[model samples]
Target: MTTPNVSTPRLKAPAEVASLELNPHDLSATLYNNDLAPTTRKGRTWSSYSIFTLWANDVHSLGNYAFAIGLFALGLGGWQILLALGFGAILLFALLNFSGFMGEKTGVPFPVMSRIAFGIRGAQIPALIRGAVAVAWFGIQTYLASVVLVVMVLAVAPGAAAINSNNFLGLSTLGWICFVSLWAIQLVIVSYGMEMIRKYEAFAGPVILFTMGALALWMFIQAGGSIAWSTGEAKTGADMWLSILGGGALWVSIYATFVLNFCDFTRNAISKKSVVRGNFFGIPLNMLLFGVIVVMMTGAQFKIDGTIITSPSDVVESIPNVFLLLAASTALLVLTIAVNLMANFVAPIYALTNLFPKHLNFRRAGIISGTIGLLILPWNLYNSPAVITYFLGGLGAILGPLFGIIMADYWIMRRAKVNIPDLYRTSPTGTYFFTRGVNFRAVIALAVSAVAALVLAFSPAFAHLSSFAWFIGSGLGAVIYLAIAKHGQEYKDVSGEEIAVAPTH
Candidate 1:
């Protein structure tokens, strides 16, 4: 069993980086060897534009419009909310850069990458948790997008709403058909593979942007063509600051699922430089501009309707032009599917596939996520804004520590290095093969920190802190992991051979 030189050069033109030969000895079972394998030595040649559009695909959705408008509930004005959003984006950019650099360096999905910090098998703990969240959101996002289709049908023929209005489990029959159809469309995209998903989003993102701009403009004009911007006045000094930060947290939580597994996307990037550049364009800058349009339209909605309209469906319903309504709704449906395909669908497929790679190749795993998605009753989740916010907050709370622990394990503890072969090994002697391929310290760190954070999230006594769950949980997880990891799980090794014995068992 052997690998070509481990000291491969990086940060070169994609043309210069040769593809890597599979390391014969380090290969794991076919399950581990599924799409999660660290064998993609020369990743797809994604330029800065691809990464930039990645954020566009990631963010350009109905949810982005809603989440941005939701921040107004915190009573922060447009400029203040924008400031908080930018701050969160800058910090997020740095975090993604750190993780994405690792992906570009390692050429593995997030689950496989976690093996460096979480033990080889233990990595499933975080992987499954992330996958579960993605699946729920995948279904929820599908349902949300389908709502637009329903709206379009109703607008085309106002009587169409009653055709399938027989409500079952909170969703009408028409709603179910639309939701299921959107789900199937996403499955088709996943069936085509990741590159196809990228190509689809590349086209969809720009078109969505134009459609959104037109909608926002129309809404503004309908709202009297004047900016009587409210200061979004706060009741108290503490409330104002809280509003901004809370808005920031919601901003973080908006795409929190992706933060835990961004490596999956970055791993496919052409180079580290490209990933960083792409994130800059995609995340912060893109969100900044997108949020501005959403805020402007939201404020216009408040003035005209006497209440803030966060949902795009509500905004489209206000438009009298049948042609415009149909066009906007159709554009939104396409954009939502594209975003769901990129953000919600792919990560979980890879994450769940990692759990039992032998049985669940990417396609099969995607089918499982899709099938399970049907059972989650995502329509109920979407209808309950308070419930869904907490659900997202809970996800942020758990993921924060997990993210902190992994980053700590990668950067602080191991100094951005790992014995690649040991990652797939089952031998107790292997560095990542601790205690039957599970690192107790990492597990304990995640459990303790996440539990404490989430307890606060659900606690009415401390419910206010839920907005900062990501920040607090991340800090606590990092600190706890840092303190415990002082025992320092083995990384440097004797012999300096940079290879592990191929496991036979």
Candidate 2:
């Protein structure tokens, strides 16, 4: 809650100013929290390696493993699933670059970045939307990680099953214990701040990759070096193509939240090249490799046990070796904790902080996010495949338009130029303080595009096109925003040099 009055004369260069160097002192108290301020050059310490490991940790999560293997259960062939993963990874890379570039260039978080398109107060639309999604995912991931803990608990003490059998509020007593334990662990870890999180990601990412490789190899050997290819109910011709496209869309939808708030991480990146390199290696290549291993492990398990276990945690449970079980359980904990904090936890903290900058800093906002995550009863959301599918589809529909609108405004209309001080200004003369601090054009575009996308995702007639909700929503949002904004004063182009010399007003 402390607002320092330090002079920031060096903030003349938007590209060079970091969080501490930015002139938040001259801006409105409501809009200029240190947590939401631009990261200083000194603050941009994340290297390409940091980004690579970050993505590695992101890919190695229990949720992602279950997500990838679930494609096989959804009638996708192993090869088809691999294709879907690759397609999603490539598309994700491109979209991440779009968001990451803005973060790197301007050193701003996602909610603040949205200000360029959504206006000052109007930016809260996307910010709150993203915060809600992040909270849900946070709860879901905590539940997923707790599943791993439950496995470890049962392994150590069989009597825990009796406790697990007794249910309340859609979760068992044992399940609640495990969930709260993992939640507390994550809460403790993230409380140390982003520097500690970054270091942990760098270490955990490689360990996870190695552990997965070993597990896959072990599973392959256990199945006598043969792969099970005919495990799914395969589709042919047009059905097959639709499955591939839809499956890829589903994969992309899983990371839709990450794609939007990628700036939260990229703002810490040392350079744009670092972000690109990290994403290139971490996303497409890492995903393809991880997918192949997932296929190997699951396909081998099918061959060995005559049935496939979709949940990676369940797969670990079946291992008779106590040592291997403990090791795998530890890996799963590390993997989930890394991803939950980096992906689910950080975004919401920033979003909530943006909502009331003067009252909330990172740590306080993080506690609120975690509390909300627990209150949502996330276990119910992850109970069935149908629920999961519709939930993600609906989420993508809402988030897609926001992405398109922000990217369109920044890359298309603004030409990558942003006025640094203007972003924090709340005065009538401020460029972003339009129409009483709200941009109705962006708001209208979001409402129209999200509603149409939601209809496509949920309506019975358009159910077949449900998977393309994100694409359709984003495309429509961009088109609609551009059409309406072209005739307005919102599209004014401001250069970097102009931002450097622009008055705070």
Candidate 3:
């Protein structure tokens, strides 16, 4: 096992490094770059318990709660929705487990690991794609998180919601403050590094899970015998079956963004077993619990308020008791911070940092990524289904294909044997160097799959297929990539075992 040399000194910025290292004749071009190399061969530092809560933290966010609400609203019964969610969660588990194995086996992040299938140069295709998705979600989540903060303000002042008459840039003065405040808080938390993040998650994950359960119980009591077992959707026959399948597809698609970048987290897990065990329990079992909470809570809201309310902030606002609202909002704030920093923010920060390692490490790249979130005007985008559908759906259309291609290249073609150092080499003789560092083959596979999926996503005639965008795109890309690549090329590792290495030049 090899490790990336994190200590290697880099130039101050890309400009200085470009001049010094970009020269075609320079030895620097082929030499492994410190930031992009395979590092941290040791596995299993993070226990299964840590891994479990890590994902639990992801589930506990308001965005997820809201997403579950929308899925439930798709006319599936509560039990039907759970069953659908279970199917989706199982698939998610299988997908993340593969990514986790790669990460645990190699100890590199998603972008670096993807270089195997995409070529070190071509790998940027998936890197930027996944990173862009992460950043978009980051913005959406930041805006979502700030709702709690804004609610906190309203809970305290009670009259501040009236100040919305004088709003700016689509957000009221108070809204702007909360958004920026959460944004800054995220930066501060992210600036502290992954250890700090895990620590915060350790504390916050269980709190939010417990809080959600308590809220569900409280609301159920308030509804007072009105809590119905029905999900308000079809429960039997063909309509119910279609609703279940359709809702399942949408449910899986929701987490497709995380599926691609999961290596960023898995690389830190203590071992392959830990990763597998964690995801199995974390995503499916824990997700089931949260689903119940969301369904119950949403049902309670409907009974009491005459409408389904999924947003925690909205529920807190309606509490009427300022003290309870204040406590609830503050608790939600902590959970949202955990979700943004750990799940949404960190991946893009690394993906972008990988793009220009000399100029940006995690901290610097993070600021730039966070700024992009602000520019996207997430306050407007967060609440809209069309925007969510386009951004997340579009990303899945491309990234799903990339994920398929990478897995096929690694697992099927290369037989899990990586010629580790060759992944970083720029020598013409190097394997991954294809036509000026880009694998046109991988690019082609991705383009075809993405274009087809996007057509479905954006077009009304085929829009129904958009719901299954992830499954279709990934399976299509895999088949196409396999058809295009050379076969029967047996590779071997240093110890003389027959192996499947990354697709090379």
Of the candidates shown, which would achieve the greatest lDDT relative to the real structure?
A: 2
Can you write out model 3's per-residue Cα lDDT over 1-505, one digit (the tens) per residue?
Answer: 9987688765578786687666433323332343344445432356687778788888777767787777657776577768888877888888888877876666556777787777877877788888887788788878877766776777578888787557788888888888898899888877766666777888887888887787888888889945655546455788778777877777777677777777776666777888889988889999899888877887777777668775766677777777877777788888877877766787787787668865776677878999998998976776778877787667767877888899999889988777765665677776677788777888999999888778877888986676787788889999999999878877654221111222110
Cα-based TM-score, every candidate: 0.87, 0.88, 0.86
Q: Candidate 2 — which residues are off by over 4 angstroms?
A: 1-25, 159-173, 380-393, 487-505
What is the TM-score of candidate 1?
A: 0.87
Rank the models by lDDT, top first: 2, 1, 3
Candidate 3 Cα misplacement greater than 4 A, ranges:
1-35, 42-44, 158-164, 231-235, 303-306, 380-392, 493-505
Clashes of each: 2, 5, 10
Q: How accurate is candidate 1 locally (lDDT)?
A: 0.75
RMSD of each: 8.5, 7.8, 8.3
| Model 2 C-alpha lDDT versus the unseen true structure | 0.82
Instruction: Quote model 3's TM-score.
Output: 0.86
**For model 1, which pairs clash?**
31-357, 31-358
Our model 2 lands, by Cα RMSD against the true structure, at 7.8
Better of 2 and 3 by lDDT: 2
The candidate with the higher TM-score, 2 or 3, is 2
